[model samples]
Target: KSKVSVIETWLRKHRLLYVGATRHPFIHSIRDGSVDVSSFKRWLEQDYIFVRAFVPFVATVLLKAWKESFDATDMDVILSGMASLNDEFAWFNKEASKWGVSLTNVAPQKANLDYCRFLESLMSSEVEYTVAITAFWAIETVYQDSFAHCLEDGSNTPEELRDTCQRWGNDGFGQYCHALQSIAEHHLEKASDDVRKRTEAAVLDVLEYEVAFWNMSQGDT
Candidate 1:
């Protein structure tokens, strides 16, 4: 039998936190078709800010992969992610216009500021590739899982929000996230014990930040 990967083991050990991040009340509301428009607007505005900060962090990871990864395809995967941000920003702008949420006037909430700061912290040259990729994977997977859940069978997700849901919940995004997971696992398998421990900690941190991000969306912060 194949050995369980480091991320798989961590997921099993921290299932509760993982569940909390992906199945938060904010997501539940969307799945149930009871989501508040105000909450959605708030989320749209704040997430745009988060994504803006996310771009540079992803760039840093791409640079790390280019310099440190043994595999050539790793840079391609990271670069594809970076390229998608252009479409992502466009979607955010359209959504903001639809929701009447002026993106220009939206201030970063405490949760968003804290989360962006965390991403900035990871961009330091001192951080190892193993730890950075672990974080990059965790961050994407949380959105992929949470948004995909809203598209699951029997979910009562509203028609108006279906496009938003499909943006991350679609099969293509799922496949992309899986590719990221594979790259993370590959590096993690060879990581030294100290770096592995740091990667595990980074995964946990990502989960906490995701949960807080959803909470901020719901105005629960």
Candidate 2:
């Protein structure tokens, strides 16, 4: 039986998450095993920058988790996720070598900058823990859902891309995303109506920004 999630239900009602999860041209092409090297490279470069900024954004969230939410398990998971970014950074460097691209001087593009700025906004004192963590869960799950499709039974995702896909799509990451969802849900349950609305809006904003970020990679922006 499938598990139920309030966030999942809310996201379904809105469709923003669905649009971001599916219909991303870059991810769709990867599923077909026909992603062009140029587009993939652009995605890699932009995503690397995003990940770099992601480190500190998540760190700030971890701080909030400690000071605000006081959820020990959630803090542990956030810490573990923060540790993994080191390996993720290494993977980007190694993957760049395999593809013969120089990532040494790449800069953040428009969509990525906007996304990072959104994270920065969440880091501000005005944003509550529920809103920030809701955004975190939404953003990570988008990538998880998008990439996991590539590993599906009939997917034509190329062997070369499968490793990258599985990096975010694998069972462990799925579990991590679930943990984040649980944390968000637990907080949301106690939240006032105003905070709940803000959280739902955060999810929508994350999806919109994610779709735009994907479009930027496809040169559609």
Candidate 3:
């Protein structure tokens, strides 16, 4: 029998933590149409900052991929992702305006700062390509899964948030995430045992950070 992929094994082993990141109470509130607008506003502002920080991390990943990946298409996929960030920023600005959110004045919350720091750590040269890509996959997957849940059938996600939800929840984004997963898994299959262990730990850290980010959105410390 073919063995389970590294990512699949880790996901199964850490199912609860994965669920916590993707199905936190804040996400449920959004799905139930009970989300406080203040919470949404807080998330909007904080996430904009997070995405700004995320750009550098993605760039670092792209650079690593260019330097380490044997496959030229790896660079192509990552480059496309980098190019797409421009559109993402435009959407964030438009949405913030619609909601009266002033993105310029928003300060990063502690959770956000912590998460950004984690990204910075992964960008170091000492980190292996396998481990860094795994963290990248986890970080993007959490957002993709969480927001996609809000768009699922039977969810009562508010109309005002539907656009925001669709931005990440759409099939195209899902496909992009799948591409990232494929890249991560491919690298992981050939990684050293030590690198694999570090990758697993990084995935767990990403989940914790995601949960804390949601908590911060809800005004929790």
lDDT of 1 by residue, 1-221 (tens): 98898889999999999999999999999999999998998889899999999999999999999889979899999988988888999999898778777889678999999999999999999999889988999999999999999999999999999999999999988998999999999998888999999999999999999999999999899
Model 2 regions more than 4 Å off: 1-5
Q: Highest lDDT: give the candidate number.
A: 1
- C-alpha lDDT of candidate 2 relative to the true structure: 0.86
Model 1: pairs clashing at backbone N, Cα or C within 3 Å:
none
| Per-candidate local distance difference test | 0.93, 0.86, 0.92
What are the root-mean-square deviations of the candidates from the true structure over C-alphas?
0.7, 2.0, 0.8
TM-score of each: 0.98, 0.94, 0.98
Count clashing pairs, candidate 2. 0
lDDT of 2 at 140: 85
Candidate 3: tens digits of C-alpha lDDT, residues 1-221: 99999999999999999999999999999999999999999999999999998899888898899889999888887887888788999999999999988999788999999999998898888888888888888888898899999999999999999998888888888988899999999999998899899999999999999999999999997
Lowest lDDT block of 10, candidate 1: 97-106
TM-score, cand. 1 vs. native:
0.98
- Give the poorly placed runs of model 3, Cα more than 4 Å off: none
